[model samples]
Target: MKKIKVGIIFGGKSAEHEVSLQSAKNIVDAIDKDKYEVTLIGIDKQGSWHLNDQSSYLLNAENPKLIQLNKSNDNVAIIPGSENNQMIHASNGTGLDKLDVVFPIVHGTLGEDGSLQGMLRLANIPFVGPSVLSSAICMDKDIAKRLLQSAGIHVAKGLVYTSANKGTISYEKAAAKLGTPMFIKPANQGSSVGVSKVKTKKEFEQALALAFDYDNKVVVEESIIGREIECAVLGNENPKASLPGEILPQTEFYSYESKYIDEKGAELAIPADLPEDTTKQIQQVAIAAFETLQCEGLARVDFFLTEDGKIYVNEVNTLPGFTKISMYPKLWEISGLSYSDLISELLDLAMKRFEKNNRLKNTVWDD
Candidate 1:
């Protein structure tokens, strides 16, 4: 049997660049060798795409802070509209292998904000995760919250601000509306790259400055005092949700360092202890949010479960972290799907969606 050529695209010009490398390494290590042919495509912080050797695509692979993409490889570019789904050498334009599907593990900004997805769509390649519209909607916290709220899903009360009018909303005004102890973060970033928990006016000012440094828009959300629960979702059309998990953050919040750099920053309780009805409710809400956002393939739907049993949808991660310790795959694993099998399922779903999309009429002919 012919092995499927799978391209694992990782490392990007995002704050989560190092985390992407870690996730890519885990995928490359655990992918079933007999079933699929793996190709490593690493993007540097400068946004250059390189065809890296699978054996030596990463440096300091064990250490999150130092892990980086190995740039000692041939640069490549996707050939848009190619019939064979080919990637070409950037300099010489020679043909590379035809990939059956691409699993883009790039986590933030250009990688996750529909830029790469749009490019892949134009290139006529099957890529994992959500569609361009869904990716864009989920990446922007402000837009996602609004959409979710409109659908009758509970979301944190927040105010969105851009560079143009960032000064108009002062910390005092925000406090009056959102109360003390708010969460400030970049509207379009992931992995909590520029997220901050602030209770004082000075911290709020600093947090806004830091968040704006990552993106033009910022979100100040009233912190929900509840257990941080997450549910992993999979499939297309009719998706399934994994047993919910809880995060015990050692810090004030799950900061960038806690999520990636520090190993003991948080304790994950898989299949979080909850009543049977509450668990069922979480699963239902997870799938509802996934479908509500038009997410395909997979996503990690985060929620705040209040002590009184109130649930609030936090955010949706279209491409959640896939590192060995990441909750996305771990949740699925605990729910019966192993890491390698999950990868295969995602690739299959991508191909299925691609075929279904191709069958649709692009240009209608009048009879």
Candidate 2:
């Protein structure tokens, strides 16, 4: 049996660039070699695409601290809507071997935000995760919340503001509406970049300025006092929710420092220490949220469980972290799926969705 050729795309022009590289590394290490042949496509923080050995420059060959695209390597462009979907070499104009599928390990902006998925759709290729619509919808916090709220799910009370509305909406008005100790974050960023806990009028103004650096639209939500819980959902048609996991952050909130920096900044409790009833309710709400978003492939649904037992759906990450220590894989691991097996399942689900989609009629005009 011939192994499928998988183009594992990593790195991107997003705040989560380094984290995406780490995810691509894990996928590279865990994907079954017996079943798949992988190629590395590295995109720089500036969004330049490169192929193969040339990508080594993006990271130190020995130890890499940041994701830097390999400048020495050749360049490849993915031209969708072509008979063959692939990255062609620029040197001799030779087309690289065709790709069976693309595993976009790109996080946040270009990767997770639906731009890459839209290209894949035009190319008529089967890439992993949700479709372009779902990806785009889930990428925007404002739209995601609206859709989830319409579905009757409990969400944090907040307001989405653009940079133009910064001064027009006074800090006093915002604080009055949402209260103090709120969280101000960029609408389109992930990994807690441009996210701040605004405890006072001064902090709110400063946080708004900082968030505007990353995105034009910012979200301000009242900070709910609760335990941070996360659940991983997988599959396309019949998605399954993994056992809940709790995050104990070492800070006042789960900021960037708690997520990546400070070695002892956070702790994870798999199959979270919750009462049976609470656990079941969280699981049920998680599935509801997943279905509400029309998500496929996988997602990590985060929540805030109040002391009185109220659960609030925070946000859904379509492309959650895949680092060996990430919550997505950890939850699956506790649910009886090994890390390697989880990777295989995701790939399988992608292919399954592709096959099912191919059966739908494409042409509508009658001759």
Per-model TM-score on C-alpha atoms: 0.98, 0.95
> Candidate 2, which segments miss by more than 4 Å at Cα?
54-67, 365-367
lDDT of 2 by residue, 118-198 (tens): 888777677888888888888889899999999999899998889787778577877888888789989998888899998
Task: Show where candidate 1 strays beyond 4 Å.
Answer: none
Error of 1 at 296 (Å): 0.2
* Model 2, TM vs. native: 0.95
lDDT of each: 0.93, 0.84
lDDT of 2 at 181: 76
- Report the Cα lDDT for candidate 1: 0.93
